[model samples]
Target: MNSNSLNNKALHVNLREADMQFFRYNCGGWKAAATLSECYQPDRCGPRRFSFVGGGGKTSAIFKMAEELSDLAVLSRPGAEKRKVLIAPTTKMYLPRDGCVLLSPRLCEVREALAVEPYVVIGQRAALPASAFEPKIEGLPSSFLEEAAMHADVVLAEADGARHMPAKAPAEHEPVLFPGTTDVAAVMGLDCLYRPVREVCHRPELVCRLLGVSPEHLLTPEEAARLLMSEKGQRKDVGTGQEFYVLLNKADGPEQLCLAGEVAKNLESMGCRHIAASSLSPAEG
Candidate 1:
């Protein structure tokens, strides 16, 4: 994509509220729209709601999109009124709900510094006391997952990994404790189970297998775009009908990046025209 293309019209979705504001200024001029719930219906447009299950790079990815697409309506949790950007100090301390709350202190510090909310922070979970747990938390309740999905325009769920021992070394691992994955599993019930895979090694076939759907059924970028238009009841752009885009956010590790590339290629082959891939980070350039 060309630098000039960055100014194109798009919809932005993000986990960090502060980043939304940053993008408003950097990406030419754009609109904002928050997904009030987790599951966003690609078929419907106008206004929609979606939920956010905090964790992973998904939140960062969403916020980046929201910033890029500044002209659209931005949707977010009504309760996220304080509008703080949180950065967890350690991996172990990140609890979806509480993490956002605890970072209020760091948020305050950073907001004061930047004259803008801090996009990241470093701290331990206050509830742990000494910073360790015997078995660690197992999983999230199905009810909570469902509730989050209900409010999002498109639920960005992490469907890999489960709560377990952390892996060691050059190989990167996906922590199995994602609430979004658990929610999807529960929603699809016995019908869906995301097979665990090494973070970088995950393949489209594996995802298809977990969903009990065919690899061929995976929609291409163009196909995804067409579906979005049809579902949202949008007319041809007149000039260009593209109203939104999907960001396939991946970890910075090489293996995960490779896997993301394959997925992007597959989506392109299938015609998902509006999808793009990027790494998750909190700096503006």
Candidate 2:
């Protein structure tokens, strides 16, 4: 496969399509081929509301999706009109790495930002190092996110908090997903394999309680996969008929890649039909 072609394809995808053509481009016939045992198409349905949960690359997924959607939004429009992609979180989060950020939740200010930039971040104000301008913008409220949905071409929301951990098990009230979320991508980092649960998993106790394992137990690929596929794992709070997508991220080396395959198998066994394993580095604007 031509690496350049894959990158270009991925860079142009509109998240609303629900067709992972870029995924096919990157994974070749292995993961993307319809004949493959693990293959399943994500539902190409409405709203384009994606709520990213789980650990690992939630932030990376949000930014990457935002970047891709922004490109498509701009390309879909003609002439000087700019289309917008909004990155908000149901929970707290740092500011976006690039683009204009609006602190106010009011719709007028958000519209003004969209007028100037295709990519915009909206949230309340938070105290942070002045140099970290984006982090200072606390995430917007859920109601505002629903309101913003009508205006932006796509809404990518980071619905869970992991406190920067590579893995996690959600608490009872965690993941705060929006009611309109059409797709929920549960992310897991492959690097956490073989590490002690306490060392790798956020909310280690929750992981232990749900998995019925000790916090110090070494995390196996199977165990990690089970955590994400468990009823209380990715399935929690997902509305009826909502789609679930598993993203096994940080498959950066041979060992991690192998583990990612196993995780995919486990997810499929547990009824997660749509899965993608990738090493997503930060995308530059």
Candidate 3:
């Protein structure tokens, strides 16, 4: 993992693909081999469109998902052909990390690449305002994303930013999703549980609003469930026909995993059908 991968929110993760099986960190990177379950055979079929929102590990989730779907190109069974996946962040994102190829904006070049590569990541170059040149890429416009979606078998897009918080409440303009998105996975970190909103949330005010609390609010597991399920949170702007999923991330230890299970139960009671728990951060000593 890069020095900044874990420090930066929803931007990068350390993942490597090998041996027909993907190797990721114990947290979800290049050391363990766990089910990249993707909440239900995310690899079922293609022309599949997936988008990620929420904070915590959204970026890591996308890369992990890419590791899962790109393998479709390697299947040697009958009718298995080179599969293509396009990772286009509809909101601002860092440039492509390891384990992915960049998608050239040129149509011919893209076509050529698709003829060989299994997956590619696409984003518009973004110029940061404060710093003197940083490597960054903002999301493509909806129209352009739609145009590019035509060539890929699977399209994975990041539709939100959380500045690395494990949880967040979306402002009115947040989470700019692709129009064709078929599934949306919302992630929150268990590490945020019991932490103060001002300390762990990307938009504390919005989260406070949703939780009916103050800046110093310590998020309980129940509050975490409420925030994850609230329309005013990461679920904002999610349209009909799009399946919504909740991922409780960074559940690192026995206690956190136990707490994540509790949150998952509450989410189920609140009518969320798709829920998963994971420790998606690199293991720390």
Candidate 4:
């Protein structure tokens, strides 16, 4: 099975259940979870790789997903072999504090961690530059990621860096996805709505270029949809048959939620297949 074949691929929640399941992460098989999310749509556990791009709460989504899959698998197959969930990155990121963190690049160590724990965070810790704040975990090599993916039940990779911003526009070499990534979620914050794009977005210059607007342009629902759909935005490096989702984040209040719904409507009109909106805790993206 390929890496893009798991249950919690990425966010695509059903809007009707927004007040309830939206924040609970109660989702499964993308289509059924359509009432919750359009992430991975597998009825049973399968080898699935999820690469999260854009920003918003991607980091939070990944670990929550790891835990969800672990519990779901354990309950679904009592007394069966435990599931393997790997949280790795294709770019620099912080290692998740919850899992059995294996910062080593060696597969033997990864195998060992997997034996002891169902969820593992694999990466190489790198010191930041002098001006930067702290050390961050660098991604594993592509070859290593591919090899590790083969041994894991679910693989979640953070492919783009957003500096914790709500939205972003990838540069020429941004969003580094690993091989066989089945689903990619372009996470953005609904809070960016009505805010100056330059203030709320990462790589605002690129966003300006994509939207043909000035840096001070405020983001609107329709413009947000355009950015989410633009090849220069979330669709960068995405291949056919691989699912792409626009996950609107930070819809914490009714006002924001309403704006998110508007964005969803705009995206639907543009023919975007997978879309979700929710308020997430502060998680890495």
Off by over 4 Å in 2: 1-29, 32-45, 73-83, 127-136, 282-285
Of 2 and 4, which scores higher on lDDT? 4
What do the candidate models score in CA lDDT, each in turn?
0.28, 0.64, 0.68, 0.71
Report the Cα lDDT for candidate 3: 0.68
Report the Cα lDDT for residue 99, model 1.
17
Shift in Å, residue 242, candidate 3? 0.7
Q: Pick the winner on TM-score between candidates 2 and 3.
A: 3
Residues 1-285, candidate 1: write the lDDT tens digits.
111111112222224443222101012221222431222222354322222211134334434433322212333334332222222221233233221122323323433422232222222334443234331121233444344333322333322221221111111233222223211110100001122323211243433343344544533333222222332111112113323333334323455444444444544554444433344443210
Stretches of candidate 1 off by over 4 Å are 1-43, 46-56, 62-93, 96-139, 147-156, 162-199, 202-266, 282-285
lDDT of 3 by residue, 127-195 (tens): 672234335567766777787788887788888888778788998897787768888888887888888
Clashing pairs in 2: 95-134, 95-135
lDDT of 4: 0.71
Best by lDDT: 4
lDDT, candidate 3, residue 127?
60
| TM-score list, all predictions | 0.30, 0.77, 0.82, 0.83
Which segments of model 3 are wrong by more than 4 Å? Answer: 1-12, 16-34, 73-79, 97-104, 129-134, 282-285
Worst 10 residues of 3 by lDDT: 1-10
